[model samples]
Target: MDHVDRTEIRPCRAADLPLLDRHLPTPGAPTRHADRFARQEAGTGTYLLAWRDGVPVGHGQVRWDGCAAPGVRAAVGECPEFNGLDVRAELRGQGIGTALIHAAEELTRERGGTALGLGVGHDNPRAAALYRRLGYGPVVAYTDRWSWTDPDGRTHEEADPCTFLVRDLTTPDA
Candidate 1:
């Protein structure tokens, strides 16, 4: 059996927030995982976390609607979106990311989403390739903008060239 199979993927819980923050720290800011967990608790969306031996190693979130890229938001319509996918640096290439993606897909399907979408940073070809391998096709290219607070609570905005990708969730094979 694969080592990744030994890892458990499940919805985020309040108890998991601290460990998530430790393992996936956001450098100069509060852990983004905490915010996602809050969103999960509020019933706005589902945040999935991967654990190995009681340690949080991966994270991803599925949004029922809205996307940063205008093209994707217009094209995918009401599809759920997978975002904020991250695996611990040392644990990459061990199937953690793939497992997180699969969990997100299953969650979207359970939510009655007929399709799922995601955006990949243009600078990150490796992630784009992984999405492609998982059956996601490019829909449009656009720029994404967002802001984050630094450790000192100073906010900064960022813009990145990105490609939006989508995959039909209506079929099991998709």
Candidate 2:
């Protein structure tokens, strides 16, 4: 927790690709970081990183257009969606993920959002508990579906059962 106190959260920069590749390589989705950066540049989303001792440790994405998941869109309207949160395997439980989520929440609030949404996979009770502790409440149950291109350019699809959640950013604790 003390180290988490020293963690810095900020938007992903062009120079971070290599650093991210070294520490957080998404081999199955080789161009993920670049694509997120492009979304950031396009003003449709934000890619945030958490740095500790000058090394990247965690990351998250905020889609300003809300979640593309149909159930989420239907349930939550257009509130910003916080997704793709990940922390270094060795750094889990150290608060890096929480810091990243806090940063994403602030980014949403700063952008005039009254609320923010996220999805917790049904099989991930740990994450569900964390989000619940963070004040996010379940909104809808849906299949979280998406596809990603592998390094070889083969596309793979995923459909995980999930519960969409939303938090009221207007509240002080949020």
Candidate 3:
């Protein structure tokens, strides 16, 4: 593992959106990742960033949802406890994303959350492996298929499946 000797955490702001959006998947499908971020910036939820030096390196966000733990009425303003963490392409795998995600999870727990969740395409084994290593586990699996051709004239889709891996906040390692 590479050494990340220095880091800082701050709130996500409008200035970071363009950089963050570039790292996100296309919006062909519906997801609250982008929209919820907008809301967070508008004082709806908590949004934070993890920076290296003076440059933006990673981010974490928290938003409310109607899907809390079982049997309870998940309120709109309740913390859903997920994040769209993006580590800059140049700085990935150096533990930036991991630190950002852990920061979000910690904040969610401080806010009384019992669980935290995030989605990843099943085809992206690299991301899945990272999440798993961080102690998140599969909670929901579903399909989000799409296709795109490359400059090499090849195409692929999300034929495999996608899933949301959740780590319970009340449990250890959360």
Q: Which candidate is the best by lDDT?
A: 2
Put down candidate 1 lDDT per residue, 15-119, tens digits, no spaces: 887887777777755757777887787887789988998988888898766474667677767578889898888898898988988888888877777778888
Q: 1-174 in candidate 2: lDDT tens per residue? A: 497889999999999989998988887887888999899999999999999888888888999998998878888888899998999888899888888888888888888888988999999998998899999999999999878887688889989999999999999763
C-alpha RMSD between model 3 and the true structure: 6.3
Which lDDT value does model 2 have at 6?
Answer: 90
Arranged by TM-score, best first:
2, 1, 3
For candidate 3, what is the lDDT? 0.64
Q: What RMSD does each model have against the real structure?
A: 1.5, 1.3, 6.3
TM-score (C-alpha, index-matched) for candidate 1: 0.93
Instruction: Pick the winner on lDDT between candidates 1 and 3.
Output: 1
Write model 3 residue lDDT over 42-147, tens digit each, in one string: 7657777776656667776665562333322222224365545666677778887777777777877777777777767767788889999888887666554456
The whole-model lDDT of each prediction reads 0.83, 0.89, 0.64
